[model samples]
Target: MPDLSTTYMGLRLKNPLIAGSSGLTGTRAGLLELQEGGVAAVVLKSIFEEEIAAEYDDALSEAARKGMSLESYDYYDYELRGAHVSQYVDFIREAKTAVSIPVIASVNCTYSHEWASFAKDIEAAGADGLELNMFFLPSDITRSSDEREKVYLQIVDRVLKQVRIPVALKISSSFSTLAQMIDRLSKTGIAALVLFNRFYSIDFDIEKMTVTGAGSLSSPAELAGPLRWVALMSRRVGCDLAASTGVHDGAGLIKMLLAGAKAVQASSAFYRNGAGSAGVMLKELSAWMDRHGFKAIADFRGNLSQAESVDPGVYERVQYMKHYAG
Candidate 1:
């Protein structure tokens, strides 16, 4: 058998398949399942910053309505936030005890604030790594790209100052200067970068005349965008790159490694195919490696990246000129 072991974000993975954060990874049972199914690591379901803030606001309003004193209000506020943080910290501790694989705690945030301080609690709870699932929609037309990009840097700086474990930033490919933004972020003392987060999209309910969320699961067809970017940026960036958002099977996993991803993260695959999907994907990866006479992941990883490819322009080509002409 070909050696499937690889290192990602400075941690050794038995294989390159990671169980991405989702409902499936939010519980101790789910973490155990993924480990049994053969994933190398697991990114715990993200604790949302908005959810914590909203709960705090609601609690304070109820306290005020009850005529709580000002000092009591302050105490209530601290306790409310701590309650939320403590649950997540406790989850991390439980996951560490439940699984032998690396447990990566995820936090979804849009700004540099008190929530960033939760990184300290997470690190203290025995999380092996932290993934900041950071993004804010660029809907505000008045905000300059620089101004918007500054928030990402601020959040990263704040979180990095609070933790000793490796930090990974999972961001959407929404920046105006996408490559430049990625390059800048890769140098920010992060251990890895997960390319292209899949955000919830709005869909119109034609008959109801209301908005609803589109399907959250990613199709295999969704793999191209991140594959292109990983191939293009893998060699250029200072930190390791992990591919996410569209990897559903072994072929997709292989493409990412060939494009230089340190590892690949998948959530939809497990949701659609059960925890065994990770094992199947790894089986395919090992078989492919054996067929190619490769003994380890590094032997051919990045063999097809833009920096190494003979037809590098294929990645940069935005139009199907030849096909259309034919």
Candidate 2:
């Protein structure tokens, strides 16, 4: 039998299949189904800073339209941030109480300051770990890359100081020097790193002249991006890597692990295939492993990473020109 179990961020997952934070992970019943589906662990849906602000804005607009009195509006517009966070913390407590596997709490942050102490609060609520989804938009053309990068480091510092629980960072592929950035981030006492957060893009309808959000799931071809990066950086970075995006099946999951990922976080596949899809993917991987004569994930994991490979140039940009020219 293949020993599919692997460790990530100090947590012993039954397999390296983490159900990433999404609508699928928001409910207790949903989380139970995922655990039952043979996943290693689950990252709860992120508590978004933008969402809290947006909700307050919607409520204020409604109240203003009704002409509410100034004295009646005594509280701050976004005071519900902690209240919502507390609710999520309660959810974690419940998840911890309900399951024997690891349960990670996620936070989607816009900046690197103040309320970062909330991470410690997550640990207190019985969360086994934390995944910081740092959202740094490159909207300010005037901002130097140094400034943008510093924010990430600052976030790591603040959160580390705030929480004793293991921390992992989920970042987008927007950095100018991604390899350097990953190396730097790994030095910050983090337990693991997830590749490429999927930001919801805005789409405009020409007929209505209005902007709307894009769909939640990733297209099949989309898997290539994270697959490529994981293969390239598998042996390069200091911390363990988890592949996210474009992973919709067992083949994709096996591909990610073969590329040296500690785990694969998926969303769209679950959305399309329903709750038990994760189980199907695991079964697929297990069957493939048996046929291939690999007895365990560790037997092949990181075989292609820069850390263990014979030709490191294969994962470096130095060979890209040759491939392009050929």
Candidate 2 — which residues are off by over 4 angstroms? Answer: 54-79, 306-326
**Candidate 2 steric clashes:** 0
Clash totals, every prediction: 0, 0
Instruction: Give the best candidate by TM-score.
Output: 1
Task: Give candidate 1's total backbone clashes.
Answer: 0
For candidate 1, write residues 207-290 as lDDT tens digits. 999999999999999999999999999889999999998899999999999999999999999999999989999999999998
How many Å off is the CA of 99 in candidate 2? Answer: 2.5
Model-by-model lDDT, in order? 0.93, 0.85
Clashing pairs in 2: none
The positional error of residue 27 in candidate 1, measured at the CA in angstroms, is 1.0
| Model 2 CA lDDT for position 214 | 86
